[model samples]
Target: MTMDELLHDPEFIELIKQYIDYLKSSVLEINTKLANGEYHDVMKFGHNIKGSGGGYGFMELTDLGKALEIAANDENKEECQKYLDLIEKFVQDKN
Candidate 1:
């Protein structure tokens, strides 16, 4: 289905809601992982979100996820935090 149609569909909307909720809950763990130098886990999480976000019609999330993934891959803590903050803000703005 087209993104517009998926956004209008109740089930798809619910699925998006669930995805956001999962992201919300993961924020803390992600932050903790970052603080601990667990870049691999963070990269994996980012990759998962990057893979799934656009499919759910949240291209912003996909973009942020890509940034996060790249930052994590580089092991750049500051850049990772920046993208993480953007992701959190995006989630807040969406809801």
Candidate 2:
């Protein structure tokens, strides 16, 4: 469904915007942590993204985040990168 169809409530849109902003911030933070080899922080950030994305009706993002979380848990960098790429594409498409 289109976002407009999936989200009828204006308040929900506002919440979604907030969640997206948070997602963007978290992406930056997580990327920084990953660059520094702080894998634990990346996992925590992925968990946050999974929860918040689901709460905001961004199911695709939530699924990607969940995958990232799993990869992070396993310290599978390549798998996590795949999920992150999906998320970036999803967000870009939304815009």
Candidate 3:
């Protein structure tokens, strides 16, 4: 189901909006940490997103998060950046 269809209640919709805002802030932090060669933090963020996304009815985000998590685990900066870009795009589109 689409996000709009899943978020039927106005309150829940607002909550989703707030979550998206939180994600936007998180993206900046993740990017900064990634630049500093801190893969652990990025990995943690990806794990968190992976766990939360499906619960929030965003499977695409979950999938991207999984990819990011895997890249971070592998310590592949280039791959991580690619997944991060995809995740950022998803967030931007949703927001």
lDDT of each: 0.90, 0.75, 0.91
For model 2, the local distance difference test gives: 0.75
- Report the number of the highest-TM-score candidate: 1
User: Which residue pairs does candidate 3 place in steric collision?
Assistant: none
Q: Report the CA-based lDDT of candidate 3 relative to the real structure.
A: 0.91
Q: How well does candidate 2 score on lDDT at residue 92?
A: 64
Per-residue CA lDDT of candidate 1, range 1-95, in tens? 88888779999889889988898889779999999999999999899989998888778888889999999999999999998899888878778
Model 2 per-residue lDDT tens digits across residues 9-87: 7877787777777666667677767667677877887787788777677777777877888888998877777777777
| Candidate 1: residue pairs that collide | none
Indicate the TM-score of model 1.
Answer: 0.94
Candidate 2 segments whose C-alpha is farther than 4 A from its true place: 1-6
Full ranking by TM-score: 1, 3, 2
